[model samples]
Target: MSVQPMLKVERLTKTYAAAHGPLTVLKEVSFALAAGESLAIVGPSGSGKTTLLGLCAGLDQPSTGEVVLAGESLGRLGEDDRARVRNRHVGFVFQNFQLVPTLTALENVLVPLELRGEGGAAAEKDAGELLNRVGLGERFDHYPVQLSGGEQQRVALARAFINRPKILFCDEPTGNLDGDTAAAMANLIFGLNRERGTTLVLVTHDLALAGRCQRMLKLRSGAAIDGEPETLAGAARGR
Candidate 1:
């Protein structure tokens, strides 16, 4: 039997009420991602990459259409229920690292567990182990400001995986790091995804980063422009 997709986006669209009129940011976007698969959404500056990601991850409501994540229909859930679903099964890493400025690395990694109503020595130990896995063990006490850009991202990655989420959504995860740092961070992300059987869906303008995924979806003018990696690379370059 064929495996079911972990994420399914059907005829998704997002529109905002502009002063002039309704400005649609995403138009009939559709895709399916199987469990443990890695997919990248690549597009130019105004192609609605982030908008699509947010919609797929249930951070935003689609103007029309549906998103089913891990067999749960997101649109059918109330906001609180959707938030519960996300907290239970979704992990995220953002372009800016999004770590709490006041929280130390270990504390930040512990946020997910605490939110789930878990805490104490076991939780602290597990959080520390995750930081160690991300090569930040000794820096657990370091705040975001005390860490380098790459280090901050590493902490974000560790924090993201603390819950052992079924799927991880990343928005421009490597956008803030330098070339070498980005490459290293990519390795850590892909490595963890493989080891944990976590599905990955990321939005990135960096072709090299997108190329590493199993599949690519290119968006043009808020609609998917289905093509191979090279074609998407061309699209990113405006060629």
Candidate 2:
């Protein structure tokens, strides 16, 4: 039997009501990603890349069409239900390293499980192990303020995977880091993604970073211009 795509969105459009009139952000963008697949959405600012990512992850509603993620149709679900779906199956890494300033790295990583009413020594241990895996084991007790940009992002990465999400959604995950730090973050992301068998959907402006994905979907003027499947190489396969 054929496997179902981990994520599928079709004819998606997001329109906002502006003082001028209706503003359409995405126009009929469609794509599907199989389990264990990776896709990059690359575009210029105001091209609706972040908007589309929010829509795909059930963080925002679309103006028209459907988003079927892991077989759950988002448009049909209530906001609470959508949030549940996100909390259960989706992981996120953002450009700003959205870690809580007051929480230690370990506590931050435990937030997701805690939200699920899950916590204990086992969850704590798992969180610690993930931090170790991401090269932040020693920084567990440190707050976000104490860590460098790259280190903070690493903590975010560990937290994202704490739930063992079926899919990961990254928005400019390397946008803030230096060249070497960006490359290192990319390596960690793809490496952990591969090791955990999680589907990756990345939004980036970096062409070289975009090239790492199995496929590319470029958006221009609020529309998708899908590219042929990429020939994965270089930084894509680690190093």
Candidate 3:
């Protein structure tokens, strides 16, 4: 028998209230990803890539259709239950790094464990190891303000993985970095993802970064195209 996909989205759609009535951001977007697979969503500024990611990650509800993550139907859950599901299986990295400015790197990495009311010695040890793995071993006590953008993003990476999440969602993960820094961050992300066997779904405008994923989904004006251009496909294949 075929294995069930780690994530499934069926006929997903999202709409927002606008002055002229409802503005639909995503329409009938559907896809599936197996465990440990990596997929990238690429699109222009208004193509609804972020919106689609949010819907898939259960951060937002679709106006219609369904999102089933790890065999759990998110569409049927209330906000609290959805949040619980996310906490249990999802990790998120954002463009802004999203670290608590006042918290030390180690502290930030420990937030997820603390949320689950886990603050035992084992949790602390794991948090420290994740930071060290992300090349922030010596920066564990540094606050976000004391770190560079790349460093802060690294801290975010460490934090995201601290919970041992099954799926990771990243939004414009390298948007704020310079080219070299972005490349390095991408390498680290892919490396750690492989190490942990985490399913990765990311929204990015950077074709080079998006190309690194196993599969690419293109969006235009809020609709998914059948396939990407030869150049994009070639880039992905080359990677």
In order, the Cα lDDT scores of the candidates are 0.89, 0.91, 0.88
Candidate 3: residue 43 lDDT (0-100):
87
Q: What is the lDDT of candidate 3?
A: 0.88
Off by over 4 Å in 2: 226-239
Cα displacement (Å) at residue 48, model 1? 0.9
Question: Candidate 1's residue-wise lDDT over 1-239, tens digit each?
Answer: 98878999999989999999999989998888888878889889999999989988889999999999989999999999889989989999999999999999999999998999987899999889988998887998999999999999999999899999999999999999999999889889988998899999989998878877777889999988853322233422321
Measured by lDDT, the strongest candidate is 2
The parts of candidate 3 lying over 4 Å away from their true place are 227-239
Write candidate 2's Cα lDDT for 1-239 as tens digits: 98888999999999999999999989998888899888888889999999999999999999999999989999999999999999999999999989999899999999999999999999999999999998997988999999999999999999999999999999999999999999999989988888889999999999888887877788987898753334465544532
Which numbered prediction scores highest in TM-score against the true structure?
2
Answer with 1 or 2, whichever has the higher TM-score. Answer: 2
For candidate 3, the C-alpha RMSD (Å) to the true structure equals: 2.1
Q: List the residue pairs that clash in candidate 1.
A: none
Q: Which ten residues in a row have the lowest lDDT in candidate 2?
A: 227-236
Extract clashing residue pairs from model 3.
none
